[model samples]
Target: MNPYLIVPLLALFLNLSLFTYVLALKGKHRVVHLYLLYAGDLSLWIISIVLYWSFLPIHWMPWIFKISSISWLLAGTLFLEFVFAFLSKNPNILLYLLRGLALAIFPITLTTDWIIGGVERKYWGDMLLPGPLYVYGVNVLIVTPAVYAIFLLLYESRKEEIGFRKQCYLLAFGTFLTSILGFLTTILPRILSQGDLHYPPLSGSASVIQSLCVFIAIAKYGFLEIRLEKIALQLYSKLREGVILLSTADELLYWNESAKEILGFSKSSSAPEKLDLGNFLDGFTRKPFTRMDFKKKSESPAKEIRIDDETIYSTGPVYLEVSKSEIPISGRDLGKVYVLRDITEKKEASEKINMLYSRVVRDLDIAREVQNTITTRTFPDSEKFKIFSYFRPYDHVGGDVLNCAESVDGKIEILFADVSGHGISSAMVAAMASISFNVVSRKGSKPKEGLLFTNDLLSSVVTQHFISAMYLRFDPKTLILEYSYAGHHAGLLLRKGETLDLPGKGGVLLAVGTPILEDYQIQLQAGDRILLYSDGLFEVRGSKGIPMGNTTLVEAVKKLSYQDSDGLIRSLVSYSESFGDGIMTDDLTLFCLEISESA
Candidate 1:
């Protein structure tokens, strides 16, 4: 055995392994298939050389030499096809001409000796002797296409990104090196020495360098689509989200481990290689997904899928937020990339929050109903006075409360209170205040004593909150009004078309402090009216941030004093709403009373 035969043997082994590996890949692109054709040609060339050097019969040398020449002749054409595919470029007229020439000369080389005349016996092995058309064949069929492919690769390298450019440069360098070594060791020597070269052809051995270079490019820089697909598969398998790749024809190109798990494929089950996307989805759900279903899903605005088949998924339920995007190469639609993220936990949590919110809203509605029942009362229909009340809460439930009771001694007791805050907590306090007011009124306590008792009850039970209230008592026989304030605004007394403030001093907020409630007495005349309200009326601020102060309310009351009790209260509320631009920041309550002339 010649020791020099080891080189071509090694080249043969490497190229055959690369070609087999590429062929065995599941989903291969055009560039990878082209590379497989190129590598198979090189492996054939190496195998011919390896057989030529072996101890074969002497008569077979010519046949082996012709096969080797034919392999070399096809090498350049296959490599150019691979280069054009890799660069995503269409074949030009030059490529078509080269292909035509290679195909035309294929039969001639097999039948005649125009390209490979004969084989010469050398010390190492048999060398191919150049024929009459050998130089033209080598230059036009082999060297021309290889050089052109390398030039195109170099030109494309300049326009590519750094990673792809490195891959291009490596492939170009490998092709250039293979061409140079083959030309020097085989073609150049054969042409120069006129078939008297001492050494056998080593172009088969030189192909090993190109193979190794392409391997390096694939391993490190992802030169071929095969490497990128492998890398994408690895990354997708490790992701928590499921990923599925499909060709434009709905062929299942690739699916990661996560996708298999999400689609309910057991570990022991073997997935079919030729399974279409529609069939895969059909197995995943109860209803089969048709081709049109997949197309609509890819184009639809709503891109979510809910899978609740207990038989498919051992778990309770699966909610997937699915998105699809088209994979395009050089403006050509290659495939679709489908990503599915499990949102079961997120959906469950949102449902829990909504449930709690609904429960709270229902409770608030019931509380509002109860509060309206307690606060809305029929004031004593007395001949001496006509009483009217209005209440509006900022929310479903509020802090402001109003209550009126007629004592056995013909004393009409009225209480208007505003708790510190809004919502459920304040509404609770208002309820407590209403009960306390009724209890104190039954005891026939004076206006000042009633407030003192109510403040003491609230201060002991409530924390971080206080109440502001105005308590009024009117004796119909004496025509005298008595009022006391607990950190509350003064009441308005309307007499002879003029507004007067029924002011009281030394009042403090209830529940938080001891109130120094002073009793204020007003000599009520026939046809005179009085109005008491919570601070929400005048504290309202408009768009300009100006509060509608008590002075404004007094002026407005004087202008509207001619209306009856119901009309007066409604008109006042409407005026305040207009002043605040229909935005309420706090609860509002108004109580109005008119003294009849017949009294």
Candidate 2:
């Protein structure tokens, strides 16, 4: 076989491969029009190769070669068609009719021998050679559209987003050189009569270069867009994020692209063992990130990432939201992509905000200590009454306070008050309420008189206002229970299996109305329990606009019949939790007292 047969065979394969690739990218790149252009060019080369290779069998070689010249016109026309498609240029019906007229000239020349030389059987072989006028006629047909296509490509390249157009220019230049050289190789020798001016030097070299370019463009280069894999490689070299990508089972694959560049590894080399993705990432001894909090296949809000001195502040999806895609060549699940973006500045800002919060918390701690000193825990105990108290605050400062003191006359006064609101202001009111209880009780005042006096004192002294309270005094010898309410929720008394609700029917809260309270007396038994609590306990909102009212309290107390004071209080909280579906909106303070036998 002639060595020249290699060029045509390579061109045939190049054209076929590109055509198939265009089909493969069918809906994706919309490159079907490119396929038609290359196919026509391949038909031209095939006919030319066969005519030259089998010149000795001249029975049909001349006719076939003559016919093959028309294929170049089709190829050139489609190249222009693709150029217009790329430039987003739409032509009218008249312009397309003019193109059809240009294409007809190729067919007319082929049949008439105006496009190629006459057939001759010389000593070399039977060669349907080109005539003197062949080069001039062929140039006119091929050069017009090919030159126009080049102009269109160059014009489009000047536009803003002309990445694909720029590539098209490279492609057109390669094909243009090959096609012009191919025509010259066939016609130049017959016209000059001195030497063949095309093949070997011009056409052969151009064909080889064109074939290599088409192979590269179709196989390696993406559809004119930069792919994520390429971007990943660039970030690996440039950014500071210590990215270590892992498979779903946590097997490491890729690591710091930046680290490798820093350590002097070429972009093509793998990461070093010391910097191997798995070993290096595992050596990062900080607390592991919580996977539960991460969104799957979605982005995250800005968050802090402190990885050693690097401090990669991530603002986007910390991991690549990779969906599974099947590689057509390999029927396997390719691993997911994990993209990480650094937001170091935003992370530092958050750290500063947290530091400021810590400073404020420290100041609040000092205030809490001073508040504790204002209220002493040395209240006198009573033998006739056993007190069980539970105080819990949602915040640093609670709104609930309870005080009990023994009088000189063997009477015991118990006071429970829930200050208005919560936090710092409420803590101050609680301190005042405790101080007032101690002073009034030391003055030997009765429960009603003491409460009225305390209310009056606070109303005048305190800035923003009043307090709700229930004050009670029990005398063992007289067997009388005296209690008064000042704008507070009533107390609950449990005797045997029955429960009683004590209504406040008296004065308003402190600082609001006159210091007058109704006094209620009830006989107590040894086994009876009385529970005092803030409105936080029963005034909780329940279903259908009803508060957990008196009726619910009665049922709760009866259910805790066998329990002691502490146990009964726990049961009430548990039952109330069940009543409100485990969500309580206010602070709960319960003080339980059991009636005991006189010593």
Candidate 3:
């Protein structure tokens, strides 16, 4: 068995296998199928070359070379036809007729030494060259068709798919180089070496290498149908959101991986019959579809489907959309391909984003806790100083700090400070100031001394944005009430049927870097009473659009002096609320202390 004969037979088998694989591949284009068929012709030529060079006998050599050469010519002609079919609207008949003519010339050359002339036998092998009309005719037939094939390939590659064109060009260039090298290295060298020359045979490996490289290029780049179609199919299957494809027969043709996960379907195939699709999606409360008969040519392709009462935990119904399109078949309508995309997550996210402020409802609950800690919690013993306090914060939280405590001298110290700003941040500062007030009062300082201490601490600790307050201390035994102001509104003192705005010029507010110099003293008699309040209680604007100034506050206190401390705070709140037209913008806090020997 000759090695060359066996190699050609094997190469022919491999080539046929590749061509068959191309036909088996599923794709949309007929031109692609034609190109693969042409490539098969080239494979046949390569195999024929192997068989011809196997050196049977002298009598068979010329006939074998003639047939193999004719096969090569047909392969090159097919290559051009493939390109013309791919690039142009139709095949060029003139080129086809010329290719037929070239084939006809092969038989004529065989009979007479007209085309290939005669084969001359040498020691190594036999060589075929042109003679007479066939001498230039062979060159014309081969080179003319080859040049045309090259040009057609160039033009087709430009018009075809980007990746496909690249692969085709790669295959064409590699084939050209290999064919040139095969002829030069084997045939030309053997002829030029004259009779005694023996050149190493150019192995069938050149065509094999070229074929494999082109096959790889085709598999990786040219034949994209399998890869792209697989991706499309997989995406339709695996999407977690519901997906449904409705075909021409009003039938469900496809579903995706996630369609089942979200839409509550089992592993039963994604495609449901049209009736089944309706049944599966029946529970949804959505706008009526125009008809259950899936329209192949619908004016609109997308619509939202709403599902109500889906689950107990859901905030509301879930919404989904079906995107539909007509799947175009060459002569047949494949109905509408519909995709069901569950947009439940997107809807939920959008709703959550819209009501972002709802989180503040939770914060309001926290604000209530802060109010409890800052207000009544500061002084637990209401029994000690006959202390009566009313604190009402306007918003969820406001800037108000109130204090009541017994000093070392048996005097009751009380004050209300208003910090600037609002919301949680201001409320926080107010809480801190409340704690500071209690701490300083327990330090056993006079009303003024405590005020100075608090002011100093607040000045260091708080921001300049806050306002300081008034502190009042009443000594029951001494009948002396002392007060200190830190940039606070005046404290009202009512005596002898006249309104007295006790003069209070104070140091800068606490937490503000201002000098601590202002303190005032007052004589407390048996019938005199004092009002300690946040500015919110007095400076509040009335319906008449006037702040309830010191004069009006003094008058209100005069009438309320006879009431107990609790009654006094209530009366003041009522009065302030009425004056402000029932609008409380700031936190209102008040503590009233009346001097009575009977208590």
Candidate 4:
């Protein structure tokens, strides 16, 4: 309400509002809040001056005087923090130690009168005589940091651009201006005039110089190009993902820390607005990164670069994935944000995985060759019988066996087996079963005897494993087809185009126990064909997701009556696969034999 209080009250309101506004901008620019905190404290010191220079309640003068010194202490402490950060110095021990000392001094000054001695009223206003240790403590904790800050600015300004250098000079000038004014108005007038004439209001005038720093600090984010909001800038700076603000007019508006380090280069020091897009890519690629294809006006999909070689300006030497999105303001391309992520560990690990995968594939190829040699046998070289064999493993190698051989006595012996499970172990069982079959068949044994020999051969060696096999002995002269099986699929006899099942009327699985082989005999007519297959061929799921049994296989064989032995086997596998929805349940094998009229 007083005339002198008007300007001070207005200054107080303006500073408080500024503090709140800058606090809002903290998410955009963290240091902005520190600047406002310092400025707010300075304003509080001014309010104390306004109170003293007016007709205040006399009792409030001492408390107001004490608080003024408190504001001075806070202003100096907060300003030190702001200055260190503005210089791009990260949080270090030295900074925290200095801050610790300031905090330590804070509790002492609040309780004791080491900072504010006593207040006396003059004709026009009140004067607070300096405390005993106030001058030294205030000068040491507050003014000294500010003086050192000016020297630091000048020293570091050497490598900076013209604009940065100008900002530094302006900031240094403001510091000196405040210090000179404080000495002149707070101390000199009282000492020189040798009277009780003391006016601290003149000390508050130093605030004009401090405003210069705030103005200069605003210019630091490149000439007020806050087109990228403070939130965006803060987010961009903190993120490992970078943000690059390139104005629609080809001007560089912003480049975050990650953008500079990851992209290799930054905006021109001589001309910040004029950025070479080519230079921008140096951070991501070892070679010249010329893939400038995403020039779409709207937001673009992310693009990845897997540089197997060296990289520049990056955190690691291995790999990087970079993406750019055009910043659209009001549906117009205002700039671009570049997000960079370091995929070095993932890239190296993937390369190792691929190398391991290649080795696995190579090993599987060798296993496949060995399994092929063991599972498949030479077909009988005969004129009366046409034997066709089919084998397919679920993956790399299979556990299904198909073999046929003609004995010296003109009797053809055939063996087909499917091991219990799939993969390398089962394929090994199939391989061993084929060897046993070949050895017994060459010995001129009957189908049942050959089955018994194979059962004994696998019983001791195969643990947690068994074989379901069918052995066949066909006499070309007699046209007598004698087939025996052990826990295997029944033979399909297609006699004059009518499907007939031999049934699984056999013994226990081979390797589980001795097998009492039951032979099923069928006389070959003018045109008779028999289908022998492993359980893997007939034990897959049907169209309704039901397990396909031999009956369904025989039905499929019936449907393919028009097909020859080879065509029918091919269609059998195709139909079985269709029911599985393109997935394989087990290793598949189908062995077929047709009798020609020459027999």
- What lDDT, from 0 to 1, does candidate 3 have? 0.59
Displacement of the residue 138 alpha carbon in candidate 2, Å: 2.8
Q: Which prediction has the highest TM-score against the true structure?
A: 4
Q: Which prediction has more favorable TM-score, 2 or 4? A: 4
> In model 3, where do residues sit more than 4 Å from their true spots?
1-367, 377-385, 496-498, 510-512, 542-546, 559-565
For each candidate, the alpha-carbon lDDT, in order, equals 0.74, 0.58, 0.59, 0.65
Clashes of 1: 0
Which residue pairs clash within candidate 4? 28-230, 28-231, 263-283, 264-283
Please give, for residues 530-558, the per-residue lDDT of candidate 4 as tens digits: 87777776677766878878777777888
> RMSD for each model, in Å, please?
26.3, 23.9, 26.6, 23.0
Query: Model 1 reaches what TM-score against the true structure?
Result: 0.41
Regions more than 4 Å wrong, model 1:
24-27, 226-599
How high is the lDDT of residue 20 in model 2?
Answer: 64
Candidate 4 local distance difference test against the native: 0.65
Query: Sorted on lDDT, highest at the top, how do the candidates line up?
Result: 1, 4, 3, 2
TM-score of each: 0.41, 0.39, 0.36, 0.42
lDDT tens digits by residue: candidate 2, 453-543:
6665566556575788888887866667888887777788877767777655566566555766777788888767788877677666666
Error of 3 at 538 (Å): 3.3
How would you encode candidate 3's per-residue C-alpha lDDT over 411-471 as one tens digit per residue? 7776677887666656766655665666667656666676665555445445545666777
